[model samples]
Target: MFRSVLVANRGEIACRIFRTARRMGLRTIAVYSEADANALHVREADEAVLIGPAPARESYLDQARVLTAAKATGAEAIHPGYGFLSENAEFAEAVMAAGLTWIGAPPASIRAMGLKDAAKSLMVEAGVPVTPGYMGKDQSPERLKAEADAIGYPVLIKAVAGGGGKGMRRVDEASAFLDALASCQREAASSFGDDRVLIEKYILSPRHIEVQVFGDAHGEVVHLFERDCSLQRRHQKVIEEAPAPGMDEATRQAVTAAAVRAARAVNYVGAGTIEFIADGTEGLRADRIWFMEMNTRLQVEHPVTEMITGQDLVEWQLRVAAGEPLPLKQDQLSIAGWAMEARLYAEDPANGFLPSIGRLDHFVLPDDIRVDTGVEAGGEVSQFYDPMIAKLIVHEETREAAAQALADACADIEVWPVRTNAGFLVRCLEHQRFAAGDVDTGLIGAEEAALTDARPSDAVIQDASDLLWRSRNVDPNDVWDAEYGAPGFRLNAARVTRQTFFVDGVRHQAPYENNHPVVRYGPQIDGGFVVFHGGDAYAVSRHAPRGAGGGGASDGSLRAPMPGKIVAAPARSGDAVTKGQPIVVLEAMKMEHALVAPFDGVVGEIGVSVGDQVAADAVLAVVASTS
Candidate 1:
């Protein structure tokens, strides 16, 4: 089944594992970096290499340049498509010591679920329940605060080595448990150099719910069910779903038989997942679920479990890495509908969601759901990686019609020179406690100002300026064009260029009439045009820019959004700051950024110094306002 596979990973999950290894006829090989050389999964691979430069530890976590570009493109097998070096257990024992075919799972099951304190002690000896707290290995801080005061006052200091919420920490009592365990041991010793920690039990309304296990190499295992992912933010996962909204039927068959007994107690194979943490205060039961960690590979919401198990988990991870086995066990897996996904992320849900790099002018995403994307319409979303940029997904037959068709396909998705959340994921699918599904992980920090309110609507800015003035062909009875109303006057004075735009929170201005079809803007902008008027409807559409060598306006320099370090700055040089104060904090991907004061300021230039590595907007402090 595997003629050539080599996808080691790049964007849109290396074009989503080369579209299931070219629909099973295999032959893929991608590997880029140099900020994904003109990306789009390196122009949809068949072969492509250059595996280095542009960070990600010198190129997608190097590992001998992805085993010499998978044996110089002979490939055979190797599809780690979920975050670089997919659960690297020494790069899956260096692709099974270079003989190829390591299509995932088994580097001793990614080193027995690669360290979340030894996979919660192997999911409590595979009875698979976990999450009680203190998986013990004593890192003495008064015995981890007497085991978080005998597992009571709101615990949770994770990070027994890398997982998104980077070295997590919660501690809601006993005076914030020794400064959140010294800031979760300095962010788990600067992100998984392993500062070792484990104290759980802070499940106060958690939801996550993962499952979707699969296996083969003949030991067989199956479950392909569950995937709620509780729409999180800091604990990563931006949105996901599939058979989970109030799941019943005997707790979804005891959480899919304890996620196929935690993937047959890690003899697991191909497409993994597990991750539980359920108990939403008291809802999805199977004795209130637990075990929170076991991704191993393939799950950046694997297309909402492949749109509710219609199956194609990377062509069943290349038909179980070419030795096929369990094709339909676990009673032929069936869920059939309701799927969702979201995760668009160029980042800027009103700036706290940070991470937004540049150039992607009018990338237009959403042609009826299922996006996936690796950046197009001219790419460059760089900041060295993981700004996500696409995922969308959707499928219906329920779950409130797949959350109202992913909120009308994210209000008709459209990205322009970088700026999206697609209107903050259409206000988190019209929020109201996420349309009353009562999700958690602080549901976007509890409706974060109505989901980063960028506020758009004077009828959606007169329909984004009458769809940008009928895409610039604005002919209002063409009297020599300009919308046909110009030449007015006895005193030769017809001024109208009063711009002041700000939609959603409303504040518009468009006083254009200096001449014909030049009327500021308005007419239910749904497909394009958006003439300005100060109230902010500039939309316009079809620009297609990408790295912007010419299209300007985003390089003034203000970097650092995820990937931390640089705690506290109070910008000095002429200090006058105002527009949203707090001047410099950064500290990358593990979250904590401030670098504010964008307007009404005075600190003209500071260019990062407190241990600077800055990327996302790279120019630390350069205010200069009084325009």
Candidate 2:
């Protein structure tokens, strides 16, 4: 094994790689940008180096800086931990050119699969089933439109160089093709610097099932079963599981064999994933699944596969990079138990899942399951990176047990201020359809109402009120202080101390009286207290007194819902726009959000333009009531 390996990434994946490297007695080096100077991964590494500024282009994605840090730290190998530079073929070659071992697939293999159009062609030649689509090189808009028409409506316009759902749009008709193409192209150029696209038939009932494939320098390849990544939102995976719930032995064998064949086609080495889109309208079958794309590095959901197979994939990567043969043959690998993983992101489901950036006031994870995270209590979640807080993985003897355990863990989280989709995740796992394994890529969208309608129960609200009352009156120095009656209350008369709170935007008042029994609140943190009641926890902080200022703007204003860059301003000042017409496009957290005109009116003062960064609640434009 290499003496020391430098992790050329950030966040949880970096920490995860370091853990495995340390266990193998290999020294680990971490590279960080200014934003991650005090990050947990930096603190955990044996040695750390500052690469560049906070922006990814200046730091994490800068090849020269990463190589310099690795060389300066005397790292014998560099592990690109699944983002940024993980799939960059040029970066892989450059690392090898610098006389450092690259702990990933061969640069040739990466190049082969880097472009979707080319990869699909390669898969077809290798006898792997592929979805019908257009992979032509003609860049004319008319050509793409014609192809879309031939493929029929409801076709997917996908960036040839895109991942993580960026640069993808689904067009339902010819009338919408041009607009979707423009949006997809803009996103593609911004994300991958390549606007080339491919057209594919959008599967109505799609189930994303990917097989984990590994190869060695000795020309040996093996399969590690598969993961069901069907639970998704906005084309991004939210939950994943191993040994797909409805998978049978025959289907598994067929998919795994196809995955190995795909790996061999590229002479692939190290860890890679062959993702397939299955038609689940009927049921999972070998013939119904088709190749979608291949991820050329360790996946984010590798933990679920690890739990079921009892193997450390990172260890395999290290050994293979060190010129070792395959750890085990395909026949020796077997699924042990079912496992599930839920990605907890710092995003608010109530606000259209907008990414939230702030300090973690009271971060806590369940102790019963495995949590892979790079942030801790008091950690700052910066706006320069992905907003995923952690990946919670659970294992059990059965899929139902695993799902229930994962759901409970999500509900048990006690994060404050920073909004999360924890409640939504819990609902997804507990939903009748999900529990029965009738899952698909559209599951979240179909059941969004149940998943996101998380309102604090009355009992929870009452507990919060009581806790707030006690926090103000109870003396911290004296635990038995009984002077905790509501202020200005007499001995016999009933007094009601009304406290107001906003839960999901709606205001609620809970009254507390000195006559009622004191409800114990948890220990106070810096900014808030965590209250538990009726098996649910609520993070409560005293609301700041409202000022005399007017309650925000009227419905005529188009304000930014979150901090982001203004990518487009279609309606200029003095331009008339109809209600629900897109006026501004804000790009944040690698996704675009369109802010529309609230009513039919003429645009007035335009406060922001393209390429301007604005904070949350900043008014982007004003619409005078023309009605």
Candidate 3:
């Protein structure tokens, strides 16, 4: 067995791996960037090393530095905790060549499943059902478009080398195929250094069902059931649960068996995921589900699988790396109950769901649920990494109970200044369709406006108003002076103070009254009270409610949604534009956000060009209104 392990990653997963390693009595080592030097994960490690600066390319993804740190720290094994270099086959081989254990799938397995096109071919040869798509190697734009035509409209163009929802696009018609393909290829080239792509028939009602598979060197592989990650937005998973709802035993058997077959085909070892996309218009069936790709590493949502199966996946990985036999035979393991996990990200849903980065002044997660995070109250969410702050996991006897518990936990979260998607997550979990188990990948997109509602209810307003009134000082001898038009008291009673607050940049006016309601409020920050209602933070502050309220008409300037690099400027100066036409596509935090035209007008000014670095609120273009 290995005596020490170094995690070649950052954030919650690193902390998670350290926990299991410590329990097994293995010395823990953490590698951090300069930005994460004071992170919680570093503090939790027995030994920590600084690899490089803030940018991941220079820090977390620098293979040589990570390997050197492991060697210097006497780490017997390197656990690439899911991201960074986890699935890099060459890096895995390099670790083994350096006479250190690599705690992941074999290099051969990673190479076999590295590309979507090649992996799908492998799955087909393994006698597993794969989605109907094009995996041919002809990279010509015309050939790809023809393939899309044959596959029919509404086809998905996915990068052969993509993961984490990057390098993917959907085209609904033949005319739009080329443009979407160009964007997809550009993203793929930028993200994965591979511009090659494959096309798939877009499942209108799709459900992301992935099975967790573990293999040992002794030729044994077992499935840990399946998880439904269909609740998604922009191809990114938002909520995931174990033992997919409405999954019949027959379908489960078929999917799990196929997943095991896929793993055995590559002679895989350690942990991996076999992702399948199901035609979910009908309930999950053996025939409707097919293989999509294989994630040859641990997933971010592995905790729910752990909760349901009652097993430490990291322990399994360690044992497998040490050439141990399977912990339990296929027949011995079974699901204990239902489990759900919600990713708590530092992002603003109202502001086009842009990543919010700053010092976390008041980071408070619920204690009742199992919360895993890598940042504390005084920590900062840097601009150089993913925005996910924590993960909230819950387990119950049934799926219904688990969903409700997880929703309540999300609502109880209290984060200030740095906005979060807690409110959006709560809506998704508590949605009536979600509760009924009638969900698909488009559920979030279909109900995004309602799910991302940034407004607080009337009751919340009343509660905030009451608190604001109580917190203020009332003068004892102020008379109602009508001549001077001053706000004061009458002879017998006091006039209600007009409580005004600025919420979401809009002024909310209400009378201050003595009424109590169950409302959660965060600590005072920047002279305002943060009212946490239904998972949304309302930064309420006095605005005086004076004059004819503030601003006027629009200037039609489109600004950068967040700090990012402008990848494409589709709209040039003097171009005719519509209200929602795509003007600039900015890539940030490993995802693409399209900044569109504000209203129907002509593009008067183009402030950014392709490859230009931009900051949040930096004007990218201006539209001159015609009407």
Which candidate tops TM-score? 3
lDDT of 1 by residue, 384-462 (tens): 5667778888889888888888877776665654666766777787787777788978778767887776655444444
lDDT of 3: 0.88
- Candidate 3, residue 422: the lDDT equals 94
The root-mean-square deviation over C-alpha atoms between each candidate and the true structure, in angstroms, is 22.9, 3.7, 2.6
Candidate 3 per-residue lDDT over residues 1-627, each given as its tens digit: 989999999989899999999999999999999999999999999999999998898989999999999989999999999877898999999999999999999999999999999998889899999989999989999999998998898999999989988889878899989878888888888777789999999998999999999999999999999999999888889999998999999999999999999999999899999999999988999999999999999999999999999999999999999989989999988998999999999899987788998888988899888998999998998877889999999999999999999999998888988999998989999999999999999998889899988688888887876676666654313344331114645457755456567654467877655677657877885556778877888876765323335322157877776788889988889999888888889888877788787789898878888999988779888888888
Residue 508's C-alpha lDDT in candidate 3?
80
Model 3 TM-score (2 dp): 0.95
**Candidate 1, residue 300: how far the Cα is off, in Å:** 1.2
Report the Cα lDDT for residue 382, model 1. 72
**Model 2 lDDT on a 0 to 1 scale:** 0.87
Provide the lDDT at 285 for model 3: 93
Candidate with the larger TM-score of 2 and 3: 3
Candidate with better lDDT, 1 vs 2:
2
Pairs that collide, model 3: none
The true-structure Cα RMSD of candidate 1 reads: 22.9
> lDDT tens string, model 2, 532-620?
43223445666532432343446588788778899888788989888878888998877788888877889898999899999989989
